[model samples]
Target: MARKSGSSGEKTRAMVEEAATRLIARHGFAAVSMRQIAREVGVQAGALYLYTPDKQSLLKDIMRGHLQHLLESWAAQAPDPDLPAAARLERFVRFHIDYHILRAEKVFISYMELRNLDCDNFAEIERLRRSYEHILEEILISGAAEGVFHHTDTRLTTLAMIAMMTGVSTWYRDDGRLPPDAITTRYVDMAFRLAGGEPLAEAAE
Candidate 1:
C-alpha cells in the first residue's frame, strides 16, 4: 500500500524512527523486527517500508542521524580556534557530557548496534565516529603544542575522555543524587586533570 501523503507521511516517518530507536536500544538490533517496530509506532508493518526500505536501512539511518546531530550540535558550541587549548578542551568535555547524558537511548544504540551493521554501513558509521573522536584528538594535540596540556598519547587520551563522558548514560538518572550540571562540572574537571590542564580559572590568567 502507498504511504499517506503530506504532513501525515512526514509524521509517521518521524514516529517510525523514534520507535525504532527505542526498541533497538532495549532489545539489541538483531532481536528487533520491522513488525515489532511498526507495532510500537502504531502503524502497519508495511507502512514502515515507506519510511525505511528495510531493517538494515533503519538501523543505519538511526545511527547516522544520531552521529550527524551530535557533530552538528558540537559544531554550534565549538569554541573559537583562537581560544586556548585548555578552554577548548573544557568546552568539549562539558558539551559531550551534556549531550550524551540527555540522549541515553540514542547513545546506547549507536554503540551497541555497530555489530549488526553490514560492512559498508559499518564503515560509514565508523568513519563518522572517528571524525567525532578526532575533534578531541586535535584539541589534545593543539594543547600539547601550546604547552597547556600534557598527555602521553593524544589518541589514547581522546578515546579515554570520550568513553568516560559517554559512560554517564549507563547509570545516570533524572532522580539521581547529582543533577546534570553537577555531573558535567565533575567531568569537565576530570577532563582537565586527565589532560594535565590547569583549572579553567587558572588557565584564563
Candidate 2:
C-alpha cells in the first residue's frame, strides 16, 4: 500500500521516529526491530519503510536529527560573539545541562547506540557529533587566547567539559535534591574550573 501523504503521513513519520527513539533508548538498538517500532507507532511492519529504509537508517536518522537540532538550538541561543569567552562558556554549560535534563532518552540513544550503527552511518553521526563539540572547542580556544581560560589542551578540555555536563542526563531527576537551576549553576562553576578559569563573580554567588 502507498504511504499516506500530507499531514497524516507527516504525523506518522514523526510518530515512527518518536517510537524508534523511545524503544531504542529503552531496549538498546540491537534489541529493537522494525516490527516493534511499527507496533509502537500503530502501523503495519511494512509501513515503517515509508519513513525509513531500515532499522539502521532509522537509528542513523534519530542520532543525526538529534545532533542537528542540538547544534541549531545552541547557535540560536548562543551569546554574541563579542561576549567574553567566560560568559559564552557559561551559556554553553547552562544550555547543555538544561537541554539534556529533559531529554534523557534522546541523550541515551545518541551516546549508547553509536556502536550499533554501521560504519558509514556511524561516520556520519560522528561528524555531526564532532560539529557540536567543535562549538565548545572554539569557545575554549577563544578563552585561552584571551588569557581567561588556561587549559593546556583546548580539545581535551572541551571533551572533558562536555562529558561532565552531558553526564547530568544519566542521573538527573525532577524530584532530585537540586533543582535544574542549581545544577546548571554548579556545572557552570565546574566548567570554568575545568577550563582553568574562575567563575564570574555573579556565577560564583
Candidate 3:
C-alpha cells in the first residue's frame, strides 16, 4: 500500500506506531503481529496496512523515528559548541537521561527489535543510531583535545557512557528512591567521571 497523507491518516499512523512500540517492548518483536498491533490501535488488521506495509516496516519506522527524534531533540537544546566540553557533556548526560526515562517503551523496542529489521532497514537504523552516538563521541574528542577529559579511548568511552545512561530507562520508576532530577544529577556525575572529567560541583546540587 502507498504511504498515507492528511491529518487523519497521520494521526492513525502515529497511533499504529505507538501501539506497535508498546506491544513490541512488552512481548519482543518476534512475538508481535500486525493483527495484534491493529487491535491495540483499535483498527482492523486490513486498515493497518494503510499506515504501514508490513511488520518489518513498522519496526524499522519505530526505531528510526525514535533515533531521529533523539537527534533532533538534542540538536534543539544542545549546548554551544564553544562552551567548555565539560559543560556540554553535562548537558548531554542530563538530556539523555531525562529524555529517555520517560519513553522507556521506545527505548526498549529500539534496542530489542533490531534483529527483526531487514538488511536495508537495519543499516538505516544503525546509521541513525551512529549519528546520535557520534554527538557524544565528538564531545569526548573535544574534551580530550582541551586536556579536560582523560579517557584512554574516545570511542569506547562514548559507547560506555551512552550505554550507562540509557540503562536508566530499563529500571527507573516514578516511585523509585530518586526523582528524575536527582537521578539525572547522579548520572551526570557518573558520566563525567567515566569520561575522566571531574564533575562540576554544581552538578550534584
- The ten-residue window of minimal lDDT in model 2 covers 1-10
RMSD of 1: 3.8
The digit string of per-residue lDDT tens for model 2 on 7-100 reads 8877788789899999998889888889999999998998789988888888888888888888888988989999999989999988999989
Per-candidate TM-score against the hidden true structure = 0.92, 0.95, 0.94
Candidate 1: tens digits of C-alpha lDDT, residues 1-205: 1224379877788788889998988888889999999999988898788989999998898889889889988998899989988888888888898888889999999988898999999999999999999999999999999998989988888888999989999999999998888888888888888888776663332
lDDT per residue as tens, model 3, 83-165: 99999999999999999998999888888778788999999999999999999999999999999999998899999999999
- Scored against the true structure, residue 134 in model 2 reaches a CA lDDT of 92
Instruction: Estimate candidate 3's alpha-carbon lDDT, on a 0 to 1 scale.
Output: 0.89
Ranked by TM-score, the better of candidates 1 and 3 is 3
Question: Model 1, residue 28: displacement in angstroms?
Answer: 1.6
Relative to the true structure, candidate 1 reaches a TM of 0.92
Candidate 2, number of clashes:
0
**Worst ten in a row by lDDT for model 3:** 1-10
Candidate 1 Cα outliers beyond 4 Å, as residue runs: 1-7, 202-205
Q: Which candidate wins on lDDT?
A: 3
What is candidate 1's local distance difference test score? 0.87
